[model samples]
Target chain A: MKTPGEQKDRTWILAAPGVGYLTVLYALPLGLLLLASFRLPEAFSISAYVDFFGDPFNWYIIWNTLRSALLTTAFCLLIGYPAAFALAWSKGWLQALFLVSLILPLSVGIVVKAFAWTIVLRSDGVLNQALMALGFTDEPVRLIFTETGLIFGAVNVFVPFMIMPVYSVIRLLDPRLAEAARTLGAGPLYVFWKIILPLTVPGIIAGIAFVFSLALAMYVIPTLLVGERFMTLSQQIARSYLYLRNETLGSTVAVVLLVFSLIVIVASQWLAGKVRANT
Target chain B: MTVLERLARLAVWTIGLAVCVYLMVPLFVTVAVSFSASPVFDLPPPSWSLRWYEALGSKRGFLPSLSLSVQIALISTGISLVLGTLTAIAVVKGRFPGRTAISTFVVSPLMMPGLVIGIALLQFLREIGYRDAYTGLILGHVIVTLPFIMRTVQASLSLFDFTLIDAARTLGLSYPKAVVKVLVPVLSPAYLSSGLFAFLASMDNYPISIFLTDARNKTLPIQVLEYLEVRPDPTIAAISSLLILLTIIVLVISDRLVGLRRMTDF
Candidate 1:
């Protein structure tokens, strides 16, 4: 180690190959993507950008994408929090069991998950069959090919991503904090709000950054569940390139999606920093 | 516990169990439907049979696509394990400037959308005149797999006792051999878990694989999606069940090797 360091800074030698590979592979590709958006229709023009923003339909698609993402993130948090809490508070074998169960779903491919949803959420599917059997409705509800179905599928797919981070954070939390709050006459809800929730902010922020970004740029779930009925940034990008044979338009939309993801990530990092500073 | 506390516990338990069930149902349905003799996708199935799984063998592109996915997954994972380990070592052990920045840069791919990465890579390769689809896909998967190895290996390295390497050195082993003997053994679990996850991530990747693949070479997920669009049958379910079975095997193996608790720490 000393000999290597003595030979004029071996750090660069060790780091250079991987860093260089990524620069060529990762950085260059993204740069070219950004560059492609500018090189519109064989001339240096911003028409792609102009065209994308010039249309109200495109703006609605962006808004719809954001709305779906925001809803998915919120729903994931709402559903995952208590489950993560339960997992974190459980002991030994029970905790392992829950962790195993959670990881199993996450390991399955997104394509399979979407494929399974076709059976569950389709008209005359199992969900509707059970509902009809229980007298919940006389007719099958149109859950498939809808925004609600898409969001539900997104939540199911991403909830594990939310729960795992929160669970990890909560596992390291002090049980005494909650116990002390309870001893001081705080209700369960109060204890959770004051003691547990604030401590898990970093994890929550991480989960939001992950689930929200994934939701915003999701191609599979939206395409599989709602298809052409829904138009999001990702779907639009794919359609423009694949079906329409328009590269500049697709790259422009992709750049916008990439920018949206980076914004969420940066914002979440800022929020996490503030929480850490406060604590 | 108080009555209210008990009630709260019961409620949490119910939700936890329900979420687990929700996660499993679709997969369970997929597996069940794969065993159906019915030609169409039916939940309960008119009769139970292995016709779909049998059909997988005779499907025109299924075997080739599965082979291509596996080959890409293995080769990409091998590349990532070597390069990502070196990078992780430099980031953790080297007294280098921009260590944090480089570390973040390496893992940033995981945070970005696969679709963006896919198209960006597609255009980049097209511009550079690199037309080989397999080469493009393997490289793209390296990007996908690198972060998993880097994060896990870096975490393990930070917690490792480097003194063991020095101790081995003092006992007359060369530094390289010392690292191979001591550090490698210590980080083997990290390697196994990370490598397994990375391999699975590569195999299951869709969005990245989509833009990189052409008519001659398509990954399993893209083929599966195409198959779903063209023919909605139990054959898709059969393919999915096989993939799910593969995942379960990996999960069980990883669980036995390093425990789920350790693997999910990330």
Candidate 2:
């Protein structure tokens, strides 16, 4: 084998490029954002944070973003958990089929998917036609250009994120635990409620964190579906940069978003650790 | 199984099938609308036709944008492959200080929203006087796509036995030579799969590209967005359908070569 000294030297050489890029691009930009957020418009001050927190409109936008994100996460959890469990339990071609189906939409462009939702949820779209034909309503339901439309699109896009993590965990779980529970005279419902649910909590929490962070930062769906009327924090930041040309304020808002995301990530990481320790 | 259990199973199947349909409907509808004879955005095309596809083929900027997207994707993927593979090797085999911190930093872009990265890079590029150019776009794409390539390569390397490389070195092959002749040949599938993923991530990206692109050197997704803004036309649908077709063809070929399922484990 090669000398340890040579291998050590070669390893550092290989490591340099990636570490350099990450340091400059990912870590450095984030540092710049954090630093810029603190810089005052006219002089060195914390005015950006003060202005962001002082404005009721900005607070409303932040609230709206969190509300929508939470709703989307809840919906995904409700639907995705069962679907993922079923997929995990499935055998042979069915499992492959489900996995492929989940991954296909993920590869499709997010903007394109948002556009597709626009087509389906429009006043004269497919849903309206079906509703009218089914004698549900004569007038088209106002599905598009609403919060409901926005949430629907968000959940649709992010459900796979929820499903995949939970599926990963569930797939690795031993089936015999549930089988043993049943054999010991436990009802199916009881076994699932007591054992399966608790064991899967980690995955559910992970999925929630993943989907929630994504939902909080979503721009395209809200932009396309809800338009400018229902402004999210991200859309507002985009407006500041592109429309208002307020780079400082725009950077401030982006910094806020980044901070909010970090809080969620840190919180979830802590919760995940606690769960692991408890188990 | 009891009747109740059977009914529950059937219900599960129904819901699963419905969710699948919900997911697939958009693509199906896009393809259907693209083939419609009319230019309107109505559901259920009155008569089927290939006029939109013909129109799309004849469009002036479409081909150029497609080619540019491919070129950018290829270059970005190449950069990511070399950088990501080396990084993965380093992380897995090297005893570097702050290795965890380095890994987290490298993969952090994957967790950040694309829009954030796009806007940050745009501002950064402006400061550096590289605004609205191909170089800026490629640099931004490499930063974002590098994480995906690195993650996959790391996964592949985790399963790789370093003993083979050691054995090759024992046979008098130089360090770089051993990596080239022994390590890479075995890891070629991971490289190819990760490269394809990186390409898709670059080609399909719009949020980041939107901030970076200008009037002259726009990517296809941005072009499609602009086209949609002007009017809702079947040409956009036609182009999207073609992209969908291309993705399917890529997946099929990949599946035939190396199973797609294994690629997803990363």
Candidate 3:
């Protein structure tokens, strides 16, 4: 029989390929990016950070990224939270259909989905056509290349992320808890506020963090739906490298964006763990 | 029940159905436009026709990129499945510390923004003097697809009955052979579900692939975007419908192998 040391080594060896690959590829590159943002090839410098923050346009970019992501997360929750209840209470084939509808759109490529939105949101597009036909407007209203259109397409893409998590939590939820609370003279609002809402908070946080992170970093949806006339951090990174050939600027913005995403993700994970422990 | 209760419940269902229709609007619109007889995008199409789907055949840059996308997806997802499964097994079965951290590290790519990863990889590749677009794309896609397989397979592994392996081992089978016999069957369905998810994520990926690809080696999404820039037409809708159909087929297969609801649990 192998020694305990040998057994441990053998077991850990199985993970080397994946862990080593990520370290070499993902972690190493991102580490390099973070390093690149702060230091020059020769010595350390804060010039990139200063230059980035010094620019009013860069502030606009950061604000733009945060605002869009916040709005996207808010809208997703507004639509998706109730839908989770609807989906969970649904029966048999209806449940399956709801799940399929959610997953199917998610499966559709972001490009195609964004492309589809352009068709709907363009001045002469389907949305305008329907709106005019329904007498909501006499002429085509501009939506493509607008902020409203960008958020609309993003929420459509990301609402599933919100719904699926909250739905899972709701699925495991004890309906009897709410029922019992109701019997004890608790109104529906009170039951929801005291029990159901508190229980689902973890799922809501996960969904919000996820959608926010994605919306904050999304490159495709904004680029397609709103066009490059508007700039988010992702677009700024792409433009810096692709158009301006400015790696330093690109890396700096990327690091900033990455920091925001990591903060949200790590915090949610910790919050979820804490919530699980408390319950 | 009070009318307030009934009213609230009705409101929930109404919003739920509205949200469902909202989620599906882009899809329905795209499919409708694909069958559009008109040259430009219009709802109800003026009349139904197959011109756009036919147009896909002769559309420049469509076929090459379509084939490229499929190839990259298959190759990268295959790698992620093999690598991710091994990683999942280690994380599940090993008594090592920081297993959770390692698992999270591997799966973190799925949650992070694609574009940042793209730029980071681009810079890293250039630093290493990597000049080939195809290899770069393969590496980038592996990063993108690995997380799907890892998350799904890890969930399955944690729930797996490892004691069965011990029972197989006690029956005069070798350790490796026992693991194979007992684990493979239960894991196969997970493989199908996660593998489909990984494949679709890779196939649909645009931001990361955009950085890795050259003009001649663009993925389908990038190619389609460029085409849309050059010529906005229903042919784009035609390609999208085909992709949507592909997703449906994948969904049906996954639903058959393992119930769709279970896939979501991971």
Per-candidate count of clashing residue pairs (backbone under 3 Å): 0, 0, 0
The CAPRI category of model 1 is medium
- Model 3: residues with Cα > 4 Å off, grouped in runs: A1-10, A135-140
Model 2 TM-score on a 0 to 1 scale: 0.91
lDDT of each: 0.86, 0.80, 0.87
Candidate 3 per-residue lDDT, tens place, B3-87, comes to 8889978988888889889989888988898898998776777999999899888888898998999999999999999899999
Interface RMSD of 1: 1.9
Worst 10 residues of 2 chain A by lDDT: A1-10
Per-residue error for B183 in candidate 1, Å, reads: 1.8
Candidate 2 docking classification: acceptable
TM-score, cand. 1 vs. native: 0.94
Encode model 1's per-residue lDDT on B1-266: one tens digit a residue. 77888898888888887887887887788888999999877788889999988888888998999899999999999999889888988998888588978887888787788888998888788888899999999999999999889988998899887788889999999989998999888888888878877888898899899999999999988988898888778887887787777778887787787777777766
Q: Say which prediction, candidate 1 or candidate 2, comes out ahead on lDDT.
A: 1
Error of 3 at B202 (Å): 0.7
In order of lDDT, best first, we have: 3, 1, 2
In the range A1-279, model 2's lDDT, one tens digit per residue, is 557666434576787987887677666666776777777333577888898899999989999999999999999988888787677767667776776677666556776778888989999999999999999999999988999999888988888778877877887788899889878998767877899888998989879988998898888789889988887888988899888999778888898888778787778768987999999
The local lDDT score (0 to 100) that residue A141 gets in candidate 3 is 88
lDDT of 3 by residue, A81-157 (tens): 99999998888887787877887776568888898888888888768878998999998888999999999999999
Error of 2 at A89 (Å): 3.5
Give me the overall lDDT of model 2: 0.80
